[model samples]
Target: MGRIPCCEKDNVKRGQWTPEEDNKLSSYIAQHGTRNWRLIPKHAGLQRCGKSCRLRWTNYLRPDLKHGQFSDSEEHTIVKLHSVVGNRWSLIAAQLPGRTDNDVKNHWNTKLKKKLSGMGIDPVTHKPFSHLMAEIATTLAPPQVAHLAEAALGCFKDEMLHLLTKKRVNFQFQQSNVAPVNTTHDEKDDTVEIIKLNLSRAIQEPDMLPSSKPWDFTGATSANFAGACNAFPGSITGFQYGPSSFGNEGAKSPWSQSMCTGSTCTAGEQQGRLQEKLEDENGGESEGGKEIRNGSSIFNTDCVLWDLPSDDLMNPIV
Candidate 1:
């Protein structure tokens, strides 16, 4: 027969702590501080277990524990971090200053984990769910894992191609929208209510700029700026893509409407050029606007018209 279970019938103290017990434990910790939880009950003159005392101090009474709503940045950081670290909340907490392991754990389980899963990211592996799962089965799974692995592999293969194709299409669309921009000058003689028709037009069209495809990092993370605390070997590095691969688009993303929902390049280029000329007259200086005007910026002296409303748009002299 198996040996008798330890403490099965032992009269061990358990359950909630009393007010008197709290007072005693609090006073003892405040004076002596807890060195060993197993000896805490004996030293503090309480019947409660050492584990109970430790939990009470760490979870409830710890002075540094911040019990409040997490800020937006904090929430974002937590979601990003969880994507890399998996469910190791204690390790995750170590990186987040003023955050408790229990709080971080609850936030992940109740909010971030579910949100990422909804966005097609596997909370456990922190990648396109299919990609992460397939990689896992490939590395550690047995021969029997084939049947179970096929679905994930097929899904990721299709999605990867689809996303890549979509990005290419977006880039093509943006390139096709480039147009010629021009500015017109007018001379006025306000004293006699007369206008001269001798005007000059200068074309300011920006060179054809390359497109930067967008990344599909819809998944929430645990940490935003910092690296993951528990990043393991072969962990899906930096969310979906490698860290070195991230590049910011110049103002407009390739997939955004500004790139995709436009006419052919020649037509768009003309309209964009015309728009830039008008915007320049009205003092517009966005990078896209600058591109349309063939000028680097609206404030650039190369194309700025000294007359008309252009001066009103420039910053006043100090």
Candidate 2:
């Protein structure tokens, strides 16, 4: 009797409630309200333990309880919330209007878990089951296609920084010139001349290539993108804007390997720095000033150079 177990007293009932007992508990709670569990059973004239009374009232006899099968949207919500919160049944139940925690847990264990497993998804991680993917593609994805993913990810980085920085007066600018790539061979004698002109004389800049923008990074983040090295890639061509990159044909920049080194893109950080610089220069935050400052950036090159990258960074594999 000292510890609470919903049935500690010798005189208290232990089995399921009969119709008569249910009525007594329900009717009493209907008028008296739900509070003070220890006092409820005594006041209701029930032979059940105090905690037993509370459980019966909350789980079964509660007037607002939701009943019947869950809807399609409800099921989806459960799966999605479980992925985010993970086994926190109370929190999950709160999101579901009238469903109880015990009900939500039971549904997940019996139905949703099986459903995800059958579809080759691990219910726990909400990702594809490893056995479903027996072999991963071993051959390197074409560098051109893969670089686009990197660029998309880079844009995502920039977008995220802009959000986090709260529109601080800052700017992002980039320019790059393409030079040729030399294989793992000795440095070519004609590397410097290529850098002096845009990509060994006349490769037109692609529409997707990033243009030099003064204070607004919105241009680079847009979807209409086709890129040459004036934006991204590394260690191939004499391109020095986005990163060190190789080109299909042209004189190799001597510093291709050492041209641009970054573990992760710093374009987003550049936004933060520029905001501070502009604000300090103008004596306050500049929402969208057309200061027209064009130069190299953390992820770009200085000077107007249309540096093209290796063909691998632009084309797709067959």
Candidate 3:
């Protein structure tokens, strides 16, 4: 059987509700309530279809309709709900007292999605942008080091998620009061010398690095580590910091040059040289700095490293 149309297209009015039509619809519904929309338009002398009347009443004519700008709390609730329910805008709207499904959908497309993207979050997946980029980067890694790349990428993702959700991450390195190195010094100066020592130690035994996990970056090679560092400019999680701890000038650390060039020195030789430099600079390690031997400390300072997991990168509600 062929389906019947709800109303005759020739006879019914279309586009834009008039004051008379609004008053007619409102008066009819007020008098007898919306028991039958199809019958109400006819009884109210409105040339509009039942669906049109229904939309007009529900979206605009309703006495309880919220017709102002959406509040911040309301916008947040909509975004949080949308993350879980996705494009099921009607369901999301149901949770919000005054919003309609169309309103919610429009707001998400026009406003909220851009806001999330600006924060480096995918609006649909609710995942960090850097995390997604890292996943793609790991696939290009050599098979022998693929697992290491995956682990390192996972750590990076977790760090991004932690930063997005928790607002702050704890690590000795991140919290330490190391003075920013003067970047204007000669390339062979003490600052550059210290950066080389710290970079070699960081690359050789990332497992010993104090972070969210001790061995999160265990098998990462110097080349891959340097690439990761370059890929994320300021912070491990791709967050921006005023000054980089590796050197004063953010990603332009002196050690990055050595790593990028693939230094020929073995890990043992690098470690030895790094230790000598550290001793020379500090005039011997402090009693509290014993952790440096185990690779638990770098840059001759107590500091924390940022790391993250692959799953649940953002809080479900945020």
Candidate 4:
């Protein structure tokens, strides 16, 4: 008996596969199951190698693939998750169920990765600040708000401490606004506006919003937060600073979009020069409000959001 190679050259061919071959290979596996790829073609009457058969089965023929263009939120989640996990398409896919590793890998290479790179975001950092901000806004609730409020207060204290040291040096020579600096102990009335502004900026920033809301400390309020801000040398008046003081409303400022843009927002209006394009398409319709609201509606709650298992599993629908 003459010996032929494991993949008999006479019967087996390599390179591009045809639809008939595809159907035969698919049908054979669908019936008998795929225990051995090398032997599959021999029985299935395919002229392709086992390797080719496997590749076609896993990449294209598999039934589980959820094919289509990725939605905006999926893009956002992918970008944000990618920031933390760089290049791990399998891991990233696990977090986005019904999405295959190959699909995500292709999407990242073809679309999202470039978009993120163009945005000047370090794709390696995996920290999609814009998406991160949206997540914070959508995830945070009243209880979470208190935690963030405290974080802001904490940041305020740190700034005040730094400012005090600077103030002593910078203002020692200049005797302006230094006349008997109201050395009183009234906590509420004797507060300084600068501290309030600094605190608000630190706390309200969308990225920081997550850490601000300490989930463990749920019932924490502004009054209980006095000790938290005690480290702040200057007194704090009221929470006078809101979103408006930041000039965020309707403003195309980067800070406005990065932090102020709500969770449920859409894409078409990301400001910058891109705003003109979006505006033109919408006939000058504002992309800021309705789009964002739509995104928010997609993930109504963290319960639903977190409940979604990552799409990284090999369990394709097929």
Estimated TM-score per prediction? 0.40, 0.41, 0.47, 0.39
> Which order, best to worst by lDDT?
3, 4, 2, 1
RMSD of each: 26.4, 23.6, 22.0, 18.9
User: Whose lDDT is higher: candidate 2's or candidate 3's?
Assistant: 3
Better of 1 and 3 by TM-score: 3
| Minimal lDDT window, size 10, model 3 | 303-312
Compose the digit string of candidate 1's lDDT tens values, residues 42-112: 78887766777888777666666778876443554454444434455655564455677788888887776
Q: Once model 1 is optimally superposed onto the true structure by TM-score, how far is the C-alpha of residue 234 displaced, in angstroms? A: 27
Which structure among the candidates has the greatest lDDT? 3
In model 2, the Cα lDDT at residue 313 comes to: 17
lDDT of 1: 0.41
- Candidate 3 accuracy as TM-score: 0.47
- lDDT at position 137, candidate 2: 12
Q: How much lDDT does each candidate structure score? A: 0.41, 0.44, 0.49, 0.45
For model 4, how does the per-residue alpha-carbon lDDT over 1-318 read when each residue is reduced to its tens digit?
875444666677877778898899889999999898878988998877777788888777877666777755566556544543456666556555567668888998877654433331224543222223234545677567556555544543443333444343121202123232232434222234433443333334434332332211133334323222222332221211112212234344322222112333222222222323222332343455533222222122432332223322111111
Q: Candidate 4, TM-score vs. the true structure?
A: 0.39
State the lDDT of candidate 2 residue by residue for 30-136, as single tens digits. 88987777777878889998888888876778777888887554565566556545687765565555678788999999887755543324467653322111112
lDDT of 1 at 220: 35
